[model samples]
Target chain A: MKILIFIFLFLIGPLTFGQEALNIIFQPKFETENLVINKTYLFKTDTLKINSFKCYITNLKYYKNDSLVHVSRKRAHLIDATDSSTYYISEHKFFRFDELRFNIGVDSLTNVSGVYEGDLDPSKGMYWTWQSGYINFKLDGTSSRCPGRKNKFYWHIGGYLPPFNTLRKVSLKLNKSHPRQIYIQLNKLFEEIDVSEVYNVMSPSDKAIRISNKLQLLFKQVP
Target chain B: MKKTKLLFTLSIFALLSFDIIKNTYFFNPPQYFPQPTYDFQKNPLDSNKIELGRLLFYDPLLSANNSVSCASCHSPFNAFAHTDHDLSHGIFDSIGNRNAPALFNLAWQKSFMWDGAVNHLDMQALAPITHPSEMGSTINDVIEKLNASEEYKTLFFIAFQDSIINTSKILKSLSQFQLTLVSASAKYDQVMLGKDVFSDQEKNGHQLFKKNCAICHTEPLFSNFKFETNALPVDPSLNDLGRYSITQNPEDKNKFKVPSLRNLSYTYPYMHDGRFATLKEAIDHYTSNIENSDRLSPALKLPIKLTSNEKVDLIAFLLTLNDKEFVFNKKHQFKKISIETKE
Candidate 1:
């Protein structure tokens, strides 16, 4: 009985010490409610419906204690609110992390590199045809406040060139030893955007840089 | 002895295979040309991919209404430039702001478009397909259309060894075809290669060109590919600020890319706005109508003084740049394979 117990303990010890999978869940929301595409909702005293929302999240970095430990091998990820597959991270193996760092859009190097597959695919509709860079964030919808045809509003923000680069960095501190989820509030973003005057922002301009700055405020850590 | 013989045979086989691969993927630029800036190592050249891109270039299915293709604005007959219109016309007869420039020797170019908006050659096609006045189609929609066709599925399979129709394959194929357009068969090229001799009049014109124009329009390729203000007065109606729109720097105001002087006979009217219809008019503008400005090119600051005889001789020298073999290359032409026949 003593020899059998010793054998069991030796085999189970290494399994416990091995690397465990860390899951990071991203929940996109409009205020307190879940975001549903094409559903009408009241935003800033105006009726609006979001038809599409897609953006690239890239260069994920992991921190242990106060030092940087590991960075994601994969360069970028295309996240669409409509796609459930994009809501979680399951590939990286990590037991614990104290801080997480990532960028909201593709970096300058990836923008100039020609024709990438998967998340950076041109067929994803996040790339600009008239220019060389990818559209970092795309937000399309219809609001009663807009004066354009069919009351449509479109904002495609992305630029890698100096003075107009819209790529933003985000850093979040984990409260618990291991965080399971992160929340991005869309209502806070909608409150700042005025659809009536600035309805269209398709090119790399001053307007795109302004809206990208506002988008950075919407990300928060969920307890 | 048997083991040694086997090793010798294997080594010979490996050497032959390596030679075949090298010939298949070589870029083969002219001896006088500078090294191409395009990183061919990233997307290696393959004949199958080039053939696939040729098909895509001539296919009208890439457009939203299935009426416009890349060849619509960039015809092969005119050195891949559209003629009969000052400004390019797109789907639904919508007019674009700028003239569609001739396409060739793209591997040597660092930037594309008149404004230099696109920084890479592979990404240049995306602009026309998605522009509202152009094809008016999304890359996703084009992929969906390509995937539905049995012909494209087989071609994609042959080119990539995978039947999946994706954007990366589509773009890489296009780049492969465009990079193969090397305009090295011109009379000017023949003279440089010591195969042909220029006439005495042409020789005189060449000397004049070197003295007056070679600073911006450099030798061999005939373009430095830098943005410079040619001193054309800004058209108040068009309000085109040229490179200023892209860079937003005050110094870059009214600067436009120095276009290659090759194929001047086929690619006209000249300039960014297509304001000059004839080479004589273009020469006249450079000598007399240069609007003085701080942003103008230093080479052109002192107005070029050309005699009437010098102008005629200069035009004669420019005509030597016309490469008929390149213009009429059947491989670059539209492949008329019917959808039913292809399937």
Candidate 2:
């Protein structure tokens, strides 16, 4: 009986400690090397500065050893594109997180009409309040190759209804057993998206759909 | 050991039963209606939170200058809608574009506003709160003020189990309180349930309403809640393209969500732009004043030819729709504690 107890303890110890974890970072690579923060335009755009860019990675789930496990939602929250101090995740229950998976735009269920707040809040500069939809991926900046000389490019993409629904699903595998960071290249997203088509996507329309489709293809799994 | 196990089991059982009773007592619904659109699971309705919402609804503190509350335009006495004015007056006596809609049975409404611009009732308050001519305050600013108020902090803690006065909690509690404003005790409801009889004139009017307007204004809720053009000419001054403003589709131009007739007596100056002041005027519009348009509802294609007597009968039928029980319910009234504190 004592030997059996010893065997059970030994097996449980490895089960608890053998799990692996990974930290996934969604890095936005700008077309130009330099990016402008709130007021100041800086020369370094390759490195994502905290508090400068706001994007949501919502409804994150972990798929390990086949079965699906739900991770704490607020754990994966808003990231700043300017300040490094503000760049880290606060709720770290998944500190030993082995894999990372999440969707960019809101899930189809939330896309339907109802009350929403936080990243889903209509006033958070992420949603188009007037249109009753979310801007799935917002790429706002000034470009010289468009009309009005200083063009403001806003990709307000999302709608569940026909002719305007722009929901995109992105899936990636961590590949390595204990990967530390996952990198996303935003420059590739713009390469596929014609600055001309996206330049005019001011609302939820066919253009928004085209841009979202193109942007999804640009998200690559890095080593 | 047996006695100790029994005690532990009893305590757990007590806590479990307490939770069950709590849920049942909190989620009582009116038998007449279907389930509410709001998923209480996301934001559970607590008595404290509901009370907090009630206070917020009546509090003028939500406004930028603290001069007007939602009740200013939508008073409880008038079934949460203002009287004597076709248009709603906002902060600094500035008039809004449309009339203030009566507030009640909101849980049943999938969309809000005369134009249906706001799809969710949770986000409904933000429109009036942010409109430059309306309250002129951001939700975040309103939250900041609520957070600073010691009284509000305690109330939020009670209602949400958390003292954080964020926009979500504010909007959720407000909606929970509004959802509880179910108006089902109207004279029409009694007549429908066969508990009471309508006057002969009211009965004839009811028949006329069924024949003429029932296609759009369906019974029980008194509204199909669908958008209809109704064939009325656009007010030249307002030029409001109701649903089209939200949809941006030319087909939805001039289409407005059908207003519920549960409290038609108190909620006067009907239609989206408050075009008709009286039931007779509205009946006349449906009869003789329907403008020819591509988006006109099929039911209203043929002009309704109602005699003066028929118009009076329609008015008599409309009077039965008034739910006096809802208007006078003390639970739906202003928070006495805050009012007393202020006094």
User: Which candidate number maximizes lDDT?
Assistant: 1
- lDDT for every model? 0.84, 0.69
User: Candidate 2 lDDT, tens digit per residue, B175-206?
Assistant: 87787787888888787678999999999999
Query: What does candidate 1 score on TM?
Result: 0.88
Worst 10 residues of 1 chain B by lDDT: B15-24
Taking the tens digit of each residue's C-alpha lDDT, what string does model 1 give over A1-223?
9999999988887667765766677777887777788999887678988898888889988777867877777688887988967877664466567787889999999888888998998878898777688999888899999887899999899999988999999888888843767777877767887888878999788899988998778777775
Q: What 10-residue stretch in candidate 2 chain B is worst by lDDT?
A: B334-343
Clashes (candidate 1): 3
TM-score of chain B of each: 0.91, 0.89
- The stretch of ten residues in a row with the least summed lDDT in candidate 1 chain A is A87-96
